[model samples]
Target: MSAFAERKEMIMTKKTAYEFAYITFAMFIISCSIYFFLIPSGIVVGSISGLSMVLNQVINLPISLITFILNIGLLVIGFIFIGKEFGAKTVYTSILLPVFLAIFEKICPLSESLTHNSVYDLVSYTLIIAFGQAMLFNVNASSGGLDIVGKIISKYTHLEIGKALTVCGMITAATSIFVYDISTMIVSLIGTYANGQAVDYFVGGFNKRKRICILSEHYEEIMKYIMEDMNRGVTIYSAVGGFDKTPRIEVVTIMTTSEYKKLLNYLHQSDYKAFVTVSTVNEVIGTWNINKNSRKSKQKEVSVQ
Candidate 1:
């Protein structure tokens, strides 16, 4: 096997390990939200666990058992609608959530509400669940339950994933009325809205990059640094200044936070009078070419400039 191929395999193995760690931690957080906050408060937000809670009231089954059964059913639906890749990742999370819930139930049961206030419990659940959901989404996985529903909604209707989650959650939240008072039901609805917004915020912020456009006489030097040192691609365009009517070369590139900082420092130290505009990009589509290209050479001489 070529050295490059071996390195690629090693990178893929490392990435898979990282993703497993992330999935586990994300499920643990969601479990904490359900067991520590939602269970005692009886707040039904838009989630599989919420649905399980509602069903448990009627069927007299354990909440964890109800959740596991519902997730099993949802997983099949997910496989049919959301694609096999999603179904595979979700299978892990769906099972882990129920298992984690059972573990917490046995080890340290929350016999009573932690905050004793519905609003506090709702907020806690929203914050923790939102963060966990964002992490899963970043890895192209989900926490199962309403996430599968949200994925279906977004895929068919072209609605944003976060909004889809809110829509599905509101429906689940409405079910709270069957089990709780009007006031508690209202709290659930509010919690559902807040949860969607938090998820949107975190999801959008997860892979954010800076889109930078630079107009400078030293465009060649800047572009070279960006390409060679930063391992980033750049696009150059010819432009005429609207006000000054001066011909200028515009260099544009998308950079991660650290790369942007390094470029900023390079410009400052070089004392270049560059006109730079930066915009926060939430996501990048297509090939971004962020990684260094592997060479076929097994061994190469090292040189320090």
Candidate 2:
């Protein structure tokens, strides 16, 4: 085979390997968080696990048993309500999550609650759950039950999924108030909100930073403010000013929205002559190539849409 063809094959192999590795790692992290940190403490922020906890209370069954049973129903519903691919992933997470939890429950137990527990710990648990969940979503996977529901919602609704999850979470939390501790429900609500927000914030954090590519003669002042004052990264690209054949130095500086707004006010006050083009960047993949392609409706939304 040609060298070029061989190189392309190698690249594809690496890419596929990386994708699987990431998904596998994400699943491991999620399982650990659920079994280790959340489950033993009855920290039901929602999902199969939360429902499992509630049912476990009445039935006097282990959460693992409840989760395992519910996951079967969810997986079937997901196959029909969502799709096959989702069902396939649910098969693993659903089964494995319970297995891991059961093993952890039998082996490792936390009798005492988290010391100094408050709204902050509530928020902290919710945030941690959100982070694991967001990772699963990023890789187009699920952790059974409501995650399947969330995916189904995203697949069908064509709306922002984080918002959909937030809605579902609130309902679950509200319902739990009748079943579990009111304080736990309130804390779950807080965690649910934080989880939804944290997922979006975490996913959008990198892309939130934008580089305003400005075409101006007053590059010095903007450069100084962006670099010296803001301590942001700036790059100067060579270009010819449109409507004038004059060669000019275009200033490109990267900063967040608030920072950009501050810089904008500064530029307006310092040099209104500057012509800046602000583009909403998606993500910076490498040293360059801001990946605007990363953000999209989740699988559940696509099904409905």
Q: How many clashes does each candidate structure show, in the order listed?
A: 0, 12
For residue 90, give model 1's deviation from the true position in Å. 1.2
lDDT of each: 0.84, 0.69
TM per prediction: 0.87, 0.61
lDDT (Cα) of model 1? 0.84
The worst-scoring run of ten residues by lDDT in candidate 1 lies at 296-305
Tens-digit lDDT track for model 2 on 1-305?
Answer: 85445655666677557655665666666766665556545566856567676677688998878877877787889899877766776676665665666776688765744534544445555666667677767656777777777778877896555777877777777767767778888877877777777766655653466769987778887787776577665899899857877899988876678888999998899889888899877555463432212111122234556
Model 2, which residues run further than 4 Å from truth? 1-13, 53-66, 80-84, 99-109, 114-120, 206-278, 282-305
Residue 214 alpha-carbon offset, candidate 2, angstroms: 6.9
Per-residue lDDT of model 1, residues 1-305, tens digit only: 85556776776687778898999999999889888998887666777777887898999999978987888888899899888978999999977987998999899977789999877887898999899999998887899888988888878997867899999999998897888888877877888899999998888878799999999998999998887777788999999999999999999999888889999999877746899899999788766833343321212212211
